[model samples]
Target: MNQGTPRLAVLATAVVIGAAGLAGCATGPVDRRALCTGFDKLGSELMSANGLFDNAVFASAGDLADLADRYQGGGLSADATALERISDADATNGFELERATSGTAKVCGHPLGLGTTSYAETGSGSTQANGGYGSYGGYGYSPPTESVTSTAPEPPTSSSPTTPAGDEVSARATLQQQVDTDRTQVETLADKWVPQLSSKNHGLVAHGTTYDYRAIWADFTATRQAYPSALLLWSGDYTSYTKGDFWVTVANQSFPTGAAANAWCVAEHLDADHCFAKLVSHTHGPRGSTLPR
Candidate 1:
């Protein structure tokens, strides 16, 4: 080989290193303004998880790390640091998780609810840290007191077994706030539990404005959001959905016995006609017959 060939190789290596350095420079810190949507979504989800008392929190440890990493990359040093602690905390330690969650709430001011360990809002704005279970806020909880009230406006009670006998205004607003807040989770549950239909299911459930989601969530709050639930997202567009289309249903599997499930419906002041035991198994379709109501 020529003596100049070694120098040529050195020059090539330097060029590659210089190009890599330039690429790194080009990919400098992300704009915080551009990160607003993502940051806000993470915050909003955290806040929702914090507010929910008895449901599975959707964010995972990896999700927490992802948000934290984004915060760090986008110049939110404190928030990034706080979330890092949560991501690194002992999974088995409830107190540590709670403390970390509370600490992160103070810094991030979203999922952990500032200065509060309680997931749900009580009259005194109190809730015990249920431990970091499935994800962020509420985790596995034993049978709680049945007197739990929620921020969601309750549907007006009457003798009607279908939708409640409320005016359009009330029906329009029934659990709307709560539904909006937990919309992501509600949809996630539906996608997991029910077969997605060809047409949208919301309009089919609209009782002049009261959608099935609101009616269903109202029932869930009665059980203090214990049982897993979702709306059967079947639209009238399908010919197969002859009966009980676009209905909301809690998981029958959550209850140990069919009697227990029926008893829950009876105890919750739910209409026996609208709220009854249903068996949804694998190989089911978006039809009433497929769901043994």
Candidate 2:
């Protein structure tokens, strides 16, 4: 029994070694190029979402806040932040991507390619005379048991590595289209509202003091909702000269472009005395900040 135990132990050791060898062969290499490809796709999709948001107009402070919260809550932000850090740390443009790919490979229990982003193929070709052609080379012909055939070393074929630039270009193009559409809608709404100011008797007119800014804001919001791609450009006072009721005129409005604002004044048929484009940077603050009513 003791002699048998020794033989079994030896056999177990051999099995373990063989198993390890098999495992090693199974986990070939990590493909960093592929990882970069996936990362690029993810980043582009996230950017597209952001662009969509930027071009959209929210109905209220709540809607604006909700959109902001959604963007932050989405995993895209975290993934993009991580990718940005990786890109920053990747001095060689190849090292960090390589290391990240390697780390992923270890976890996945497989080896991937350890090289720059490139393609390669290894192949060889050979032409040999087997018996002869037609009937001579038919299955009936029994060739020599040992036949010498020389194989030619075929040239390696490779393709250029894919780049992330194309994704960025596409994203940019999509965003620009959104911007143009949004701008046009805002202008159209401006044209509609300018005439309504007097007929609807909605805002601070020729001699009115108290301005229903919120109502006007709501009107613009509704107009923007009609055009889904319009952005939340503004919802504030359009002041020309400010003071008390005696000399001050505060006609508050919201608009996407300076041209639209100026067009509002034109549509209202107001002389240069009352309203003008209140050109300044307008942004509804972060998700939780005070939103313009």
Candidate 3:
């Protein structure tokens, strides 16, 4: 036979003898031959039980029946109970291991090796050790820090020119004039379109004057065509009892005026009446009107 096999057999024999001696010390004198037989049987049962457990835990369907047979041949009844307990423990642990593995794989976007936590480092050098089992790059690795260069501030070049008070007043007047011109254009467009509506609806009341939706739409369209810098919000179907259909709405920031609101509707390409009825200004009132309950 192989030299290693003999050495292993000798070592096993020595272990069995030592175990029996310890048992004898605990109890009374034990028959060496009987104890040796028991040891042999116990060793075989332990090996078979362990193999069965490993197979079940790893989802490997091996010759479990054969292993079970060897386990049954063990000297004590407790051996069977011990085997069952081991199998139970392995099954429970295996289920937990599978769940933990799957969860970590999904969250970390990678598979974890055996006995590894979800936050375990991926080969990509990103550490996921800080978070829980499913957390990626938890406490194990540090984030990269970017180097910042500090520069001395440059001295002021020449003294900046200061505008006279009269010049500042002129600039303000010019800005107000532009504002007024834009407002007048918006009003004139409303006047042209106000008569087209079937209902004698008053124009949008802002800053004390009513502006027609069509006029606002014209001005909004013109502005968009010219600058194309207006903020566009989303438009979609809005169902309500009073309003038949909801259209697009736009705003200077979000939804500043009726014109901006109508602009949003037109951009979204929704029906005008539907968009107006569904506007935020119309939503505050009672179920049928613009007044809040």
Candidate 4:
């Protein structure tokens, strides 16, 4: 995670809330009201991109493309172009899209991004105080201050290690074997979960990858004091979504609906970045599904 910036989920939420690029706005010139209403519904992943072509940014391409498809001939050619640019920004190196987003807002008679609001980081890690994507704070999700590829906790290193290299190699091999085995089990579980969760309609998802099922489950729920009944899903080996590293945490906590689950998230302090409302339906694979209505 970049210490300088919030998590990508938070970034996406920020983009959705105020990135200014028209998402599913009305079929006309990009206006503030229409943009505010429409931005949060699409292209969040692209909005989250910080001008770098990496896995997280690239992961949103498919979703953004779908949104673009919906807006192809909707009298928002500039908006459509912006969406297309953001959708393909990773592949075509078009990360500099201010003209179509915030710049467009300026043309639409608004200097601010989305509306007359602002975002700030709270000490508790919540992004904002107003009713925006950054406001949801939640339990659990103690993201490591540093990025990690494997599930193993870091053990303190000795100034001079006396352990045998052969022994260390054997241990690593065993760990890798466990990882492979765990991934298969997680794969099966993820396949089973997609349709099941989708059938329910909506869920608050804490998206992540790399950790195995047991670790992911504990981290997303019980360990951090989140809903224990939450379901865990993984992105299988095959998917164009963000290099296919798996694990998505869906809190099964009950709520009629708030921001399509945003209210529940706020109650738990789960922001759109750390957690977002998802349909949890047939839109499977590593990337998960569309935002809830």
> What C-alpha lDDT do the candidate models reach, one value each?
0.35, 0.29, 0.29, 0.34
* Residues 1-293 of candidate 1: C-alpha lDDT, one tens digit per residue: 69999999999999999999997764444333323333344434443543342222233433443444554334344445554565554431222223333323322322232122324434422223322211122211111111122233323322223332224334334434434444444344332232211111223322122233323333233232223243322222223333323323333233434455556656644444334543333333534422222
Candidate 1: regions farther than 4 A off: 1-16, 19-31, 37-67, 70-249, 252-293
Please report, as a residue range, the 10-residue window in candidate 2 with the lowest summed lDDT: 132-141
lDDT of 2 by residue, 156-207 (tens): 1122222112232332233233333344434444422221111011223222
Q: List, residue by residue over 1-293, the lDDT tens digit for candidate 4.
A: 46646677788888887745564343334323334323432223333333334565443433333333354223345544665665665352221232233322222222112222222324422122222212222212333211234433332122222211223333233333433434434444332221112111012233222233222322332222223244444333334233223344455543333354655655554434444454332235435433332
Tens digits of per-residue lDDT for model 3, 1-293: 68899899999999999999986764333222332233333323332442233443332211221232243223323322333454445342221222222322222322222112223335542333311112222111111111112122121122223311223233223323333334433333321111011111113232222223222232233223322333221111122223221112222223434465445545544334323322222123324321111
Better of 1 and 4 by TM-score: 1
Error of 4 at 17 (Å): 60
How high is the lDDT of residue 130 in model 2?
Answer: 15
Question: 1 or 2, which is superior by TM-score?
Answer: 1
Model 2 residue pairs with clashes: 28-111, 29-111, 29-112, 30-111, 30-112, 30-113, 57-230
Instruction: Provide C-alpha RMSD values for all models, in order.
Output: 16.2, 28.8, 29.4, 22.0
Off by over 4 Å in 2: 1-32, 43-181, 188-293
What is the model-wide C-alpha lDDT for candidate 1?
0.35
RMSD of 2: 28.8
Worst 10 residues of 4 by lDDT: 194-203
Cα displacement (angstroms), candidate 2, residue 146, comes to 84
Error of model 3, residue 43, in angstroms: 86
